[model samples]
Target: MAKKANWKELMTLHLRAYIPALVAFLFLLPSPVFAAALSLSPTNASVRVGSTVTETVFVLSTDQAMNAISGTISFPPELLQVVSVSKAGSVLSLWVQDPTFSNADGTISFSGIVPNPGYTGSHGLTISIQFRGKRAGTAAISFSPSSQVLANDGNGTDILNDTNSATITVTSSASAPSTPPAPSTAEQGLLARIISSTHPDQTQWYNRPHAIFDWTNAQGVSGVRLGYDKDADGEPSVPYSEPLSHKELDLEDGIWYFHVQEKGSGGWGPISSYRVQIDTVPPLPSTVTFPQGTTTPSGSSITALFTTTDELSGIDHYQVAVDGKVFTVTADAGSRPYQVSAGPGAHMLLVQTYDKAGNFSTANGRFFVTGEASSFFDFFSFGWLAVNYISIFLIAFAILVTLLFAAWYIRTHFMAYRYRLNRQLGLTHAHVHKEFDTLKEAITEELLALEQTKSKRSLTREEERLIVRFKKLLDHAEQTIEKEIEDIQR
Candidate 1:
């Protein structure tokens, strides 16, 4: 019987431990639900005050088939103003709510659904939001926590597991030149007499495949010669032709310059010129490359190498933003390897490449900064645990100091008032005076206890309530004493 009892006890102990382990294993198992993510393209941007910036939102499905998505993106209205919201390339076929934006509140919202056999993979483009920089500051474009991506399953399971946000920096307009330089003397003189041509006006844009050159000389000059080339020089591939009133020529799509000279026994005067641009297509988009994930030490900056290329017009400039702050803008293609200083925290860096013809492309990466808390006041340190403790300590210290000063001031002033009232009323031991003295003593003791407690921990809820009660009692005693003094004076 003793052996059987021992065996039963051991079985009970084993079962108790096994039950929790089984439950934990079950809980750790993956759920049937799928995970989805949403992110912003060109996740960062920088613009000058009064300029505009645009970014696209995208949705991706990791494992689930998504049928519907709804989300709201918020921004700081003081720094950025919503200009427009477009759904031109959105993947969702059915629109439950059209994308809309408000400048007043700096919010953009949209909701849409895909038809049966719900969309999968990258849900292509979602929507594009345009914002005009209103001030010189950094602003975060974030998705509201309530945003949702619903699965196609009949239950409408929320599959949203992650969301990425974007940042915008509005800088002073003086960062870049605002206007082009004035025309040179030769350019001015040549531009004066260049008559109209069949191609297009001087310094104008044209998409035509051919150009008809024409000239006029009311002086009835001996001969007129013409030279044309894509280069700025007067020397053309075909060389100068004999005097001709008009000539038809086929030309490729690009900027072309034409020079005309009049030969009136002067043997060809200075070459007069006009220019026409024949850009039939937009400049090719630029490619931007940067480090994927980087970690930097505390109090240090991370430098991201960036390379870009443009086939047609060549790269013009690059803009970089870090953690939603505008870091720098380089006007030349040679400017590579951008860098930005960051405090301890996770940050996103973005780079934008622009071609000479204004076409642009963007690339972004995520990085983290790690470091220990430098001091008690360095509450912004990256370590999560250290920051929490320091924050609590600072808050408690502020409250304790404020309460002590208030208590001391109130006690001193009220005591003086009571003494003056007693003298004025000629009452050394009135009921109001006695009550005031009792309350004053209570308040002084409570304040002393609070000061002592501050050395240990923050004020508890009960202690805060007691402080409020003490203040009320002091106020009542003051009113009673004032009423008695007024009666005695009358």
Candidate 2:
């Protein structure tokens, strides 16, 4: 009985080993009938804007049961925006390369929710160890196969392994710009002109509620667009009108340019351009009121006065000068007339007033400063007195002589100018000589024409005076020419 039992156990072991070997041969042998394969489902998955999408990566094999198989999906951050990741099952592990897959760990991982929520389309995560979703735009996520269970036949011979890959695309959700209707061109006979209250040029200051520019046209204007600019090249300020009109527009003081677009049934005509420059700077104080050549002392104080006003900024400060030196007034006195001090001897006293905006005006005048009494040597000697008297007379005489010479030179030069002008205008030299025959003739003809004519129906006095003065000027020229001819003959 023992011998029989041993033989039976041996026979059973042999049978077991032989049967597995036969199965292995059937699987591992070179047979055209059998093959191994692996693949993924939904290779190109897409998700809607602001939504989540889940896809299963299959490790499909011809064999019913395979072991030790793992897979991973990597997402490109540039392509898809990742929010979070989740993992499930002991067999699967999750890692994220914020680029392709979504997990806290910075690695290409699988077995978890990839790319946090709110990420959009085609997160094409490249094949890299550590992934940072740094790149953006249309991207893709590559699903790659990880090692799986190795399969063997009954004879312990390895049969095959499983592998697969896939890619997904993400789409964008931005909109496009509005399309404008096709533009048509036609002449609408529309005309625009600007009228102003102060300056017809419409670019200066005069009074409040100052009118700058106004336009009129024959045809009724339906709509208009108004555009303005400050600097020459910068983008224009935001356009002020959709349908512009004659409504009042308040403007500040500076260079300004304007353009208007008129709309009608015949389409919009070429834009009309107009400009206005408003200045609120108050005019400088007038009537500087200087004395007739007052002498300034060597170091004495001199004072001058002037009134000032500002339409916008109030007067801020004032300065007084003697030939532009020596401080005069240094205290603030509001809008009152201020005084400045200067040194003596025909000193030029100027009062410069400044507005809050740094606009300035100047008033010029003169002052005298006498030295302290009895500060000189020898008061009552005839010799000294005579010499002083002679010096005074000589100075006065020199000044008078200078004045006479200057007057003569000026008169002669002016006659020359008149002669030249008459000749250029095709008038005779004799006509030019009559204009400068005397001081009164010269003044009435050249300087006092407008004054003399202000009350007359026309410029009769001015015209008559100028004609006679011109004839005198021509006579002088003729005489000069005749003298030169006589010299040549001699």
Candidate 3:
């Protein structure tokens, strides 16, 4: 018991570590894992050679909430030719791969997932097939033994069970309508399937009130009785005479079912139903937002969350636009944060989400992008890098100051040099030699006058002192002028 307990404890710890990964893995699963019975409607039927017949494939019964389903229906290519396949009123919310068929392979294949709360019903339609009879023979339609179903059963378990197949007996006038023979109740369950043309896709919500339903009227079939209502088991009450192959209705905005029956000489046949979903109103107005607030750090991308809801048909796709330019249209990112690529600036983000019915709602918000410049290139786009804003501003300020100081110093030195050149050339300065010569002659004459005055009157003490200062000044002036002239010439 201790060993067993320890083993369970270890497993619990392991699961705890992987819980997130497991949840993600299960959420994306496209096949149901619950044990469910799969069956083809009208399990047995007879078709005239060269004529077409319709069959529906759906989940017959399941006790668990199955989230995903996948299957392949195989038929004998020699006896039956593939006509078409439709998933109009299917229970699948998302198709991993759309239903497709190949006549050469005699197979119809589909893989899809249902939303959470999965699907629990007797008749969860998966897909419908139309096959044409080629010759007189028995063509058996059966699900491949390896069909799959997935469920949210606390574990990612995949469970599949045996299938209830259909037997198609193609004949050559063996049971002609002119001399009709009674068929087994199963073979005559529904002679044909109901199909819509004006509202072809049952999964899509449409605004058009006008609808047209068409069906194949088997041989000897006279009138058709049909009923339009919201009830699933709605019976056919209105009757039209023979040769009627279609019916038309102008319906209101709601889910509607068209029940149809055909009457030959033997009385009313079994009824079949077709679904028509109508939604004229658009998705409720909602917003798309950036989780990191409206303003984001300048980066390569920003994530947007769309909060648009549709109660009737559900949300389908989302389109994102930045600064009036459409960026991306996505179906996967509708429920999650969608990443948007934009340059740093004030940006207008316009987001639009569409419902499965083609109705859309729009919301927009404004945001700014900024950051430290990554490199020299960032200087041009200044705030788009991952650097500190204060630091970037300070660095830019210092660079501007340095550039201005350098320019000032260069201008100052150039002006000083030009002043010296002008002094010698005399364009913007006093001519050094000419002015010096004038000053020298005046000084020499003044000195002579001072000496003469001194000799004339033994000179007053002031006169003697003046003569001495004049001689010294003239001598100093001569030496300074000579040096400047020599330097300018050099």
TM-score-based ranking, best first? 3, 1, 2
lDDT of 1 by residue, 144-180 (tens): 9999999998889999999999989888766455333
Off by over 4 Å in 1: 1-33, 176-490
- Candidate 2 stretches greater than 4 Å from native: 1-188, 202-212, 231-245, 281-368, 371-490
Query: Which one wins on lDDT?
Result: 3
Model 3 poorest ten-residue lDDT run: 424-433
Local distance difference test, each candidate:
0.71, 0.48, 0.77
**Candidate 2 or 1, higher lDDT:** 1
TM-score of 2: 0.24
Candidate 1, residue 88: the lDDT equals 58
Can you write out model 3's per-residue Cα lDDT over 1-490, one digit (the tens) per residue? Answer: 9999999999999999899899999988897344777889889987767555778898854668888888888999999987557676899979897786789999888999888778887788988787778888898999997688776565645655657999998877555542455765743854658789889987667867898999887777878887888644468788888657778899976668888887876877877778898766676666767897776677667777876656455567877788767765656667777777677788888887787778888898777787745776766455555457778899999999999999999999988987887565553125656776788788779878877876676777887787788778878877876776566645
Better candidate number, 2 or 3, judged by lDDT: 3
Using lDDT as the measure, name the better of candidate 1 and candidate 3: 3
Counting clashing residue pairs in each candidate, in order, gives 1, 57, 9
